[model samples]
Target: MKTRSGKGNRVGLAVLGLVLLAVGGLAIARALGSFGDAAAREPVVDAGARSFAATTPWFWPVVAAVGIVIGLIGLAWLLALLRVDRPRRLRLESGTTGVTEVDAHPASEALAEQVSTYPEVRRAHAVLRGPSDDPHLDIGVSAEEPADLGALVTRLHDEAVPDLRTTLGLRRLPAMVRLNLTGGRRTRPVH
Candidate 1:
């Protein structure tokens, strides 16, 4: 849960501390050795001088530590990007009583059960509209065949408004049963 900038700062500080420790340790060792006076110590002195002028063994450790810190910073940045880029997941369920698995029921079944009680609606379907409205029921009806479209629309509006209000206890229904007419074709399976 740490932010990328915070993670980077922590890693940078840790690496800097380690590099400082290594360099300080080497300098202290050289300074201590220089205090001794002896001809036999000449090579040691020369080596220490050369090491001070040139890169020490600690150089690679510092580089590796810095590399690790940079890698960690990059990794944290990538994770933050992925979190923002991922799509959200949605979960839907019916608010009706005794309907445990609304998703499992076909759209036709849901429409028939919930909206078809009115004489106007002949067929109904539950549909999920992604990035549009929330989950809703779409109904298909026939005015020419045994039902009237105006009456059906009115009946559906009346029943749906109150049914959804009382059942879901929502101030307003999020979706409505959209009615369509097709000449006697069997309603497509809701799933």
Candidate 2:
């Protein structure tokens, strides 16, 4: 859920991608060379198997165990990539009846939309995190050129925070709002 963890996952994937690409390229090159001369082609499995057969039986077990460990490590990396954070459902009180459950996505999206309406804002994203009863709003926003950072923060604190709290029927909602400036290419001045 943290930014560092997400970055680490990406780094792992990139390393794996590079390794696979190198291995595949080697295989393709070997295959193409083999096509030119059938006699030059070597038995891939037989060569490795014969070498292993000459070694002690214990060596085979050690090699197999190392392969299994590497496979498990790869599996763990894959599972981390596939992980999805499930947001908790917010419970709403009805008229002297059982509570109604609602998905937090709608409310979060609406809040994000409101934030995005600011003149300086280019894009905004919001997600409800933590416990359903006491949730945290995680917002990411990108701003246009020459945007006033102070004013933006003030507006989010004064306007957006109250709006979200009142609309969601909560006393306090902890928020993490991340702001970034949008990139724009500079034009060269001509004399």
- Winning model by lDDT: 2
Name the candidate that leads on TM-score.
Answer: 2
What Cα-based lDDT does every candidate model obtain? 0.54, 0.82
Query: Residue 39 of candidate 1: its Cα lDDT?
Result: 40
Worst ten in a row by lDDT for model 1? 84-93
> In model 2, how large is the Cα lDDT of residue 186?
64
Model 2: worst 10 consecutive residues (lDDT sum)? 34-43
Give the TM-score of each candidate.
Answer: 0.32, 0.55
Give me the overall lDDT of model 2: 0.82
Q: Write the per-residue lDDT of candidate 1 for residues 1-191, one digit (tens) a residue.
A: 33666788679779989999998886666656755545434554577767765667777788789999989988986676555321132233446553333232343355457765555455455443332123333445444355576677677677754664344333444454555665554577786
What TM-score does candidate 2 reach? 0.55
